[model samples]
Target: MASPHRKGSNIEGILDVKRDKVTVSPLGLDITWGGDSRYWRIDARYVELIQVCWLEVNGSVEMKHLEKSTKYKLEFKIRMKPDAFGWNDSPVYIMAMPGKKAKCIWASVDLSRIKKSEQESSLIPPRLEFTTPGPESFHEDDRMSFGLFEIWKGRWKGGLVIEGVIISRA
Candidate 1:
């Protein structure tokens, strides 16, 4: 049960989505993330899921400050621990929406395979891409919602570590 805050850590309890680009830490998520210290390790940089049956991590960002008429990518920078389990049959999905009234876009990935690939290069983690609308299409107060979900499986899973959600120009 390590504290998610430390000296010089960029992690924030509340995210300022008004920035041009930003990273939303686990602690900044808008929803209640389940798991105690025994099942989760929260530190300055990331949140490690040691074990869990239901997974639902979610967050959102304001679209006003983002570049208008531009495409943006919302991705979860994550990796799997060597002993990760329950992901073989479970495919975690990354989902996003440009505005509150917009349709949602999603993509699925296998965490077990991601772990292998990450161990190979240890460079960039996998990212899911999504495009946003121009300023003319949405109001200034509109916000884009996004998250990683793996609840349908209903099986206990573990060993997934999440750095944060990166929102950048695509």
Candidate 2:
């Protein structure tokens, strides 16, 4: 079973994107803010056709607001349900944007046998470490926007239940 998705002010990560701040698909998809100020859940119960029509998930956060000098990784905490599809044999696209210093990555997901809980969510490969630029680097503002947008080769995907994007370090 998956952990109940809820929201709390203290919850961390870019997962808690304000409704007005969400720039993902507003068409053919229902993006819901999991009834909390700190959770982003897209109520994508069904996607028409499930093809390469729309294949992008985008999000971001301010580096300055995060703990200074801390190392963190951006990951989509997802638990694949039994009916999960569109994820097999398809690679996801990830990109980090910091003043044009963007790092885009490709992620392959095999959810066919994974447990159906965020606790079962595995670490994305090619672990990318993002060190907070520290407070000194911020004079005007320092925002870091990263996302899993577009499927490799324009493949469409579906049936992905997202707990949220988690920013954490070992």
Candidate 3:
């Protein structure tokens, strides 16, 4: 595509998730008028389909009940830019997957003070594969899900821009 939006364009994009549908574009991802990476970087991942904030409030999609008694395979992929930002440190990507208990899926490469370029891959997102018990197993009648993503720079931080998709099948 046209690379979405140019950096430092003072624009914000969003991801709209709907039933049987998911769309992702670009966002400002930073507080600066120009999307500049000073300390923080970018990270993107996908998770199981759950209650989308926008669609839920508008009643655009029916709340499908997930049988927690069954088993589900949740997959996510994450990536980050090593340097381009004005950061002197290399940050790490810490991933978390929620289940019966909160679980740490994997940690990205530790750049912390490691000499490297800004365009390298500081965080190497490993293949995160996990399984979950169906909704029927839960005591509640509501939909069951897990938080898919969280992006940040270890020391100095700035705007975090991320992109990805979540897929679920019965």
Best of the two (1, 3) by lDDT: 1
Q: Which numbered prediction scores highest in lDDT against the true structure?
A: 1
Colliding residue pairs in candidate 1:
none
**Residue-by-residue lDDT tens digits, candidate 1, 1-170:** 74432222335554646455766776666322443566677775677787777777777766765766677777777777777789887988888887887889888877767744333322122556666776568666787788778889889888777777778776
Task: Give the per-residue lDDT digits (tens) of candidate 3, residues 1-170.
Answer: 43321232222234344543323322312212222222223333211111111100000111132233433323222223343232334434334333434244544443234334323322123333433344543444232232222234333332222343232332
For each candidate in turn, the TM-score is 0.78, 0.55, 0.34
Q: Rank the candidates by TM-score, best first.
A: 1, 2, 3
Model 3 vs. true fold: TM = 0.34
* Model 1: lDDT of residue 92: 81
lDDT of 2 by residue, 39-150 (tens): 2343433112222324555555555345656566666555555555665556565555542343443444454445554235554434645655545564225566665544
After TM-score superposition, what is the CA distance of residue 61 in candidate 1 from its true location, in Å? Answer: 1.2
Give model 2 RMSD, 1 decimal. 9.7
lDDT of 3 at 139: 41
Q: Against the true structure, whose TM-score is highest?
A: 1
- Model 2: CA > 4 A from native: 1-53, 98-126, 134-136
Go through the candidates in order and give the clash count of each: 0, 1, 16
